[model samples]
Target chain A: DQQVKQNSPSLSVQEGRISILNCDYTNSMFDYFLWYKKYPAEGPTFLISISSIKDKNEDGRFTVFLNKSAKHLSLHIVPSQPGDSAVYFCAASAFIQGAQKLVFGQGTRLTINP
Target chain B: AAGVIQSPRHLIKEKRETATLKCYPIPRHDTVYWYQQGPGQDPQFLISFYEKMQSDKGSIPDRFSAQQFSDYHSELNMSSLELGDSALYFCASSLAAGRETQYFGPGTRLLVL
Candidate 1:
């Protein structure tokens, strides 16, 4: 069963516009959430993260919003740039056997057009 | 600025053959995690280790085994590989004492014929 889901397979946006990607999770035990951006044939790069206790976290042009009651979270990139075009994955972290385990979404491919 | 390292970025093997993948975590990191990603699918966690000991298990198969060395490197050994085993294998590392942020390797692309 897929505990984390990113329903949107792909998204297209104009350069300098805002882009938003959504993710949902079924496990309430997850205490930490993170977003990673991956380019073709490359490892995922860390973007931003939020804790279960907080509703929002921002870093530069990227922001993450969490709604615990809705079991949903979103990543917002303002003034999207060409370099921002990549696959975005949302992952949930849960502690099991005193170690952190991550569950990832299917990933959303974002394309920024100039 | 150093990140996780994985060896043999690509590999090809026949069914029933064995393959070994290696991962070297960043200096001073204490935790290692392995994941497998099939085509058009999300990454699935296979196993993890912390401080040279097995810490967690996931969807790993009986034919697969892994271990972390004292030097903080890990290896995944797959035996009797099947066609379905062809996928991208990723290794991630983090500090057990830090927040849950895992830095992933570039991934090893394995193709089992």
Candidate 2:
């Protein structure tokens, strides 16, 4: 029943500073929200996305914030670098039947220490 | 820039052996999704398809099965296999009219014994 929740499994930043990652959801009919960036074995890459009437969305250094009455969502990666570490997933987009489905979160292993 | 393609990346079977995972989308994409990550958990959607048919379904099981052809490529036929079905099998692609971005496929590390 983990309807998306990234309770911070791990996070350690420093490289250039600024690196936040958090996510929570319980299905509010999820409208769309994404952020992926895996590395180890690779597979997830697309990063940044938000829509549920939007709260914030940026693309240069990566940024995504959505509140939607606190269902929570966040992913900021300012100066941070070092390939920006890895493992950071927070996805939510539902539209059953007609397809479109993604609900993941249980990843947050960013570690960029220079 | 092309993405989403998976194959034998890795595999090993035994108990009740039977596995066949493949996916190749992203070239006119049409939608296809399948996920399963288990060691430490997180990714878990189990089925999806669009242009070829079978639209949605998750937590798949029942010996597992999937399809989506017509040159779109998709397959995931696991049978009997167990040992928690060793994990890590992802394949994602989107274009059901840009179904909100989805492109992944660098996984297929199954191991059952």
C-alpha local distance difference test of each model: 0.94, 0.88
lDDT of 2 by residue, B1-113 (tens): 98898998889999888999999988998888889998877789898888888888888998999999999899999999999999889998888824469989898999999
DockQ of predicted model 2 = 0.27
Provide backbone clash counts, one per model: 0, 0
Identify the CAPRI category of the predicted complex in candidate 2.
acceptable
Docking quality (DockQ) for each candidate: 0.67, 0.27
Error of 1 at A41 (Å): 1.3
Model 1 per-residue lDDT tens digits across residues B1-113 = 99999988999999999999999998888999999999887889999999999899999999999999999999999999999999999999998824569999999999999
In model 2, what are the clashing residue pairs, if there are any?
A: none
Off by over 4 Å in 1: none
Native contact fraction per model? 0.62, 0.66
TM-score of 2: 0.35
